[model samples]
Target: MCIFCKIAKKEIPAKLVLEDDDLVAFHDINAQAPIHVLVIPKQHITGIGEVTDEHVTVLGKLLVAARRIAEDAGLSQSGFRVVVNHGQHAGQTVHHLHVHVLGGRPLAWPPG
Candidate 1:
């Protein structure tokens, strides 16, 4: 099973921020920003290429959850960034679909 699947199943511990029946949000182990959180669907849909219309609800839930987490972390007013790496070429180390909520600083343009 994928690492994220383990996290969703509660077999692997995660610093959870928000969780409901369909999705979960947690702190990133390798935080890129002062406030970096990962929001993922519990269904293990792999990557964006694999997502179908069936995933629309969970996908939207991910963003909604990310927004809530960012606001709770006090980044709503300061602004934040939400990103999804599509594949390995795009810097997606994990196969499972996930959203990165990054903030707590003045983010530069042309993010590399």
Candidate 2:
């Protein structure tokens, strides 16, 4: 199983922020911002490239969870960024589909 699948199955420990039947949000081990979190679906879907019609609901939930986590972390007023890296060239280290919630500081335009 992938690392994210292990996290969802409770086989690996993550700094959890939010969790539900279909999704899980946790702190990024390698944070880019003061408040950086990763929101992912429990069911592995590889990455955005693998998303299909059936993955729509879970994909939406990932955004919802990212928003909620940002708000709970007091980053809603300051603003936050939601990002998804689709492939290796996009800086996607993990194959699992996940959303990056970044905030607590100024983010530059045309982010990499």
Candidate 3:
């Protein structure tokens, strides 16, 4: 199984932040900022391009969900950023598609 699947199934340990039937969000073990959460779909998809039109609603839902989680995590008025890395060159370490919500400090432009 993929690393994310393992994390979801509890086969591996992760700093879980949220979960449900179709989605899951968690704190990255190695965070880039004070608040860095990774929200992912239950099914395995390597990138946004891999998501079918049937997934469009869920895709949008993930964004809304991320916002909700961000607010819940105390970033509502403070603002935050969402990111989806598509491929290896973009810094995607897991094969599963995920939305990264980051905030709690000033973010640099032209991300490194």
Candidate 4:
């Protein structure tokens, strides 16, 4: 199984921040900001390219969860950033579809 699948299965440990039927949010192992969380689907999905109409609900859930995570991390007032690295060229190290929620400091433009 993929690493995220393992995390979702509790086979791998993650600093879980939020979880529900559709997705889970956890702290990024290599945090880029004071509050950097990864929100991923419970089901295994390679990347955004693999997302289909069936994934619409779960995809929306990811954003909703990110918003909640940002609030819980105390970035709600200052605002936060959400990123989805779609492919290898885009710096997606892991194949699983995940959203990066980052905040708690000033983020520069031209992010990679």
Candidate 5:
């Protein structure tokens, strides 16, 4: 199983922010921002490229969880960014589909 799958199954430990039957939000091991978190679906969907109609509900839940996490972390008013890296070129190290929530500082216009 993939590392993210292991996290969801409780085989691996993650700094979880939020969790439900559909998805989970956890702190990124390699944080890119002060308030960085990774929100992912419990079911392994590989990446955004693999998403189908059946994955819509869980995808929505993932985004919602991201927003909730950001608010809980006190980044809602300061603003936050949500990102999804689709492939290797996009900086996706994990195979599982996940959303990145970044905030707690001034973000540049052109993100690298």
Candidate 6:
């Protein structure tokens, strides 16, 4: 199983932030920002395109969840950024699709 799959299954420990039947959010072990959260689908999918219409509702909910997490993390007032690394070259280390909610400081442009 992939590390994220292990995390989803609770076979491995994660500093969980939010969780439900379809998705889970956790603090990245190697956080890039003060409030770096990784929101991932419970049902592992390789990438965004692999997600179907059946996933549309959950994807919407996921975005909502990210906002909620941002508010909970006190980033609502300051604003935040959301990111999804689509494939290997895009910087996705884990096979599971995920959204990254980050904030708590000034972020650079052109996220290279």
Give the per-residue lDDT of model 5 (tens digit) for 54-107: 998998888888888888999988999999999989989999999999999999
Q: lDDT of all predictions, in order shown? A: 0.93, 0.93, 0.87, 0.93, 0.92, 0.91
Q: In model 4, which regions exceed 4 Å deviation?
A: none
Clashes in model 5: which pairs?
none
Q: Write the per-residue lDDT of candidate 1 for residues 20-111, one digit (tens) a residue.
A: 99988899999999999999999988898999999889988988998899899999899999999998789999999999999999899989
Write down the RMSD of all candidates, one decimal each: 0.7, 0.7, 1.2, 0.7, 0.7, 0.9
Give the TM-score (vs. native) of candidate 6: 0.96
Put down candidate 6 lDDT per residue, 1-68, tens digits, no spaces: 77888899999999999999999999998999998999998887887969888889889988999999
Count steric clashes of candidate 6: 0
lDDT of 2 at 18: 91
lDDT of 5 at 59: 86
- lDDT, candidate 6, at 60: 92
Clashing residue pairs in candidate 4 are none
Q: What ranges in model 3 sit over 4 Å off?
A: none
Candidate 4 per-residue lDDT over residues 30-101, each given as its tens digit: 999998999999999999999999999999999999988888888888999999998889999999999999
> lDDT score, residue 19, model 5?
89
Q: Which should have the higher TM-score, number 3 or number 6? A: 6
Scanning candidate 3 in windows of ten residues, the lowest lDDT window is 40-49
Off by more than 4 A, model 2 = none
The ten-residue window of minimal lDDT in model 4 covers 67-76
Q: How do the residues 1-100 of candidate 3 rate in per-residue lDDT, one tens digit apiece?
A: 7988887787888888888888888898879989999998877777886889889877987898899989998998888899999888888888888999
lDDT by residue (1-112, candidate 2, tens digit) is 9999999999999999899999998999999999999999999999999999999899889988988988998997889999999998999998999999999999999997
